[model samples]
Target: MSSPPVSAPPALEVTGLSHSFGRRKALDDVGFTIPQGRFTVLLGQNGAGKTTLFNLVTRLYSNRSGSIEIMGVDLRARPTVALAKLGVVFQLRTVDLDLSVKQNLLYHAGLHGLSRVQAQARIQAELDRLSLAERANDKVRQLSGGQVRRVEIARALLHKPRLLLLDEPTVGLDIGSRQTIVDHVRQLCATDGLGVLWATHLIDEVRADDAVILLHQGRVLAAGDGATLCAKAEVKDLGQAFTKLTEARAA
Candidate 1:
């Protein structure tokens, strides 16, 4: 006898997504999926519809033309369920300078409706992961840029989100800090079974094994693993492959 179908779900699913503002197309037919326990990079340059997609997924801008599903919950039809399983760290700094690291995280925990006891435990656990347990009482302004960024990550995870979304997470950090943040996130996928949708234009951030969705001029130019995209572009490296594919699209 045939076995019953399993109900496995991707971390995120977007289909036929399109958005615009007064005839200016911000996104056009964007679609992709980020699998659980993997890091997927949303690669696009400035004004390439990356942020627009993020806004739609987070429901900051409702998607009128398509669908967004998070771990099987549709954003439009079940925003509460979808959002509860999703965590976001935008490109801009979100930490309050006056608040201590623990306070900042606790505040987020409270917002997520975690009780004080539950919030304290979760706060300690996440801080420990980022090596910020010792500095929990330190004000955000006293931490380095990289440290602050790590705190933001911990805050995002405070709600115990299954899918994490980060936009240009490494912007303005030095090479060391960037590597640290990147490696830490990849570790989360491997260790915690977290699904990541990391949006960035930086070519170096994409490993050869990572899944990639290339967005260009409000459209998805390509979607697949890095090796697949490289093969499609007929280039040996991601940097060269990106240029080749984008140049072709521009032609």
Candidate 2:
């Protein structure tokens, strides 16, 4: 007899998720699973509810009618517990401009209730990984945009989260800065086995093999490996694939 198929638990899972305002549905029964250690990008145009989904995951906007599980913990049942295993970098720059990089990190560590010694060690390690050790004491405002962005990332990782969520993190950054941030995030996800959900408008930032969910008009129109979807359309890159997909949806 053939063996039964094995199943792997997802690092992040959403089921029957739906949200709406008066006369408007922002998310209509959207569902997807992100396997552990994958770089998953959520793609969409404005008003497609990409950020709304991000907010749902982060619990900024409560999910009135769905389930979200992170690392097997139900977000609604145990929000704090589920959130503890996740790190987030929002679309806006979140670093304290007046605070030194080290100080900013220290504050974040404290927010998670880390002791001084523990925070110090964690901060040092993250700075080293991002190659920001040499300028750790500089105020964030004094640093370049790229450096400030890196500091925000370092702060997010101070808790040693297993899942990282970045919402349009590279928005407004120069080409070089954008590439640098993308490279660092890609490397971190691959090397540390960290699950990442990066929401962005730029198709070039996501790799073809990475998982992708295309949100259109408050609905998920497609979800799969980027390369596979692109191949289905004979597209050379994600940009072309996105154009094809969205155009078809509109038609």
Candidate 3:
């Protein structure tokens, strides 16, 4: 007899995810599911609540009322356990300027309960993958902005998390550094089967077949593969397609 097909669980899922401060709603009834092993990018304008959603997913701000699941685990019911299975690189640089690259990575691993020996092995492996092995002992302050960002990436992967969250990760980097980070992320997602949510405003970083969610005015304006979505409108690029979609919806 032929074997039955296997179904993969969603890497990230959210339902009725609404949040507000005073009179303004940052996220309103937003819901979406990201399949396993895809590089999903969330596109939005300023104040569209992309950061707010990231915060909720990372459990930085408690969801007053909503459901969030990461790697099939409900974040609310088991916040700590759920978060441990995920890796995150925020918009801001978080590495210690005074610490050596290796030392910073070791500290991150320790927080995830990785033993010194195990963490060291993992850190070494990641540094090698990033081609930063030669500079492991160099202080972060001595490295260029691009090199420091690589350290943060290495730190996030120290525990081998199933999901990776990058919030505007290349926001302020130069063109070369931005391209480097984008390329590395693409490779990681494809090779390691790590589900990625890359929040950003740059459309060039989006791949033709990658999944994407468009946020406008705190609501999901659209969601699907970026190229597929643009094709439907017969547009050449994301920026134009987004403008057409939102304008048509308004009319």
Candidate 4:
């Protein structure tokens, strides 16, 4: 008899994850898996411990309990190997305002140990992909908020990480700009086979086919595709489903 095909591990996985800030528990027994080559929305309202989870995953904060794994590698046991597969665009912008877009990207590339020639090629590819090629020579301060956010996204991808994390990436953008980013990232997932963990409180960003993890008060209330979540909640849309889930937990 032929053996069944073995399945690849998730792009990212968290098991029994928890964190605290002194007396306040920021995350409580949180766990979820992000599949490879897919876009998974970490849906939660502000102060829902979304950032806390990201911090732990990125090693910005020490994980006091539980575990994080990236592409089947244990983060605690093999941090460098685990982190090499991760990319992040934080909620706060980190690019230097005085530096040109290309300069910023080159600096980031150098940090990842890419040589100047290699960095140049990757920089061109990302800038072109993000529609920022014309703006590559312009100082970051010269760009609009939406353009700046695009630069951050491009910079994040320079290292070619398999898993990309974005925390509240569209917080202050116009609807058009927000939608542009949403479309571009979705296209990346389809074309490049990149796995994304997008953290957002915005309900409109969640699509029916996308994987959704509903987090409230640092706990995962639901995990499934958007359509399935709506069906399980007995709701017609994701917004109503989210409200029903959170409110039920509060009660």
What are the clash counts of all predictions, listed in order?
0, 0, 0, 0
Native-to-model Cα distance after best TM-score fit, residue 152 in candidate 2, in Å: 1.1
Per-prediction TM-score to the true structure, in the order listed: 0.96, 0.93, 0.94, 0.96
TM-score of 1: 0.96
The local distance difference test score of each candidate is 0.92, 0.87, 0.87, 0.91
**Rank order by lDDT, top first?**
1, 4, 2, 3
- Alpha-carbon RMSD of each model: 3.0, 3.6, 2.8, 3.0
Backbone clash pairs for candidate 1 read: none
Superposed Cα deviation of residue 214, candidate 1 (Å) = 0.6
Off by over 4 Å in 2: 1-8, 234-236
Q: Give the poorly placed runs of model 3, Cα more than 4 Å off.
A: 1-6, 232-234, 248-251
> Which residue pairs show backbone clashes in model 2?
none
For 1-251, candidate 3 gives per-residue lDDT tens digits of: 12212466677898989999889999999999876678899988777899999899999998988799988899999998899989999888999999999899889998999999999899989999999999999999999988888889899999988789999998878999999998998888878888889998888888878898988778888899977779866798877887787677668
Better of 3 and 4 by lDDT: 4
| Number of the candidate with higher TM-score, 1 or 3 | 1
How much is 167 displaced in model 2, in angstroms?
0.4
For model 1, residues 1-251, the per-residue Cα lDDT tens digits are 12212466888999999999999999998888888888999999899998989999989999998899999899999998899999999989988999999999888898888999999999999999899999999999999999999999999999989899999999999999999999999998888778899999999999999999999999999999999999999989999989999999999
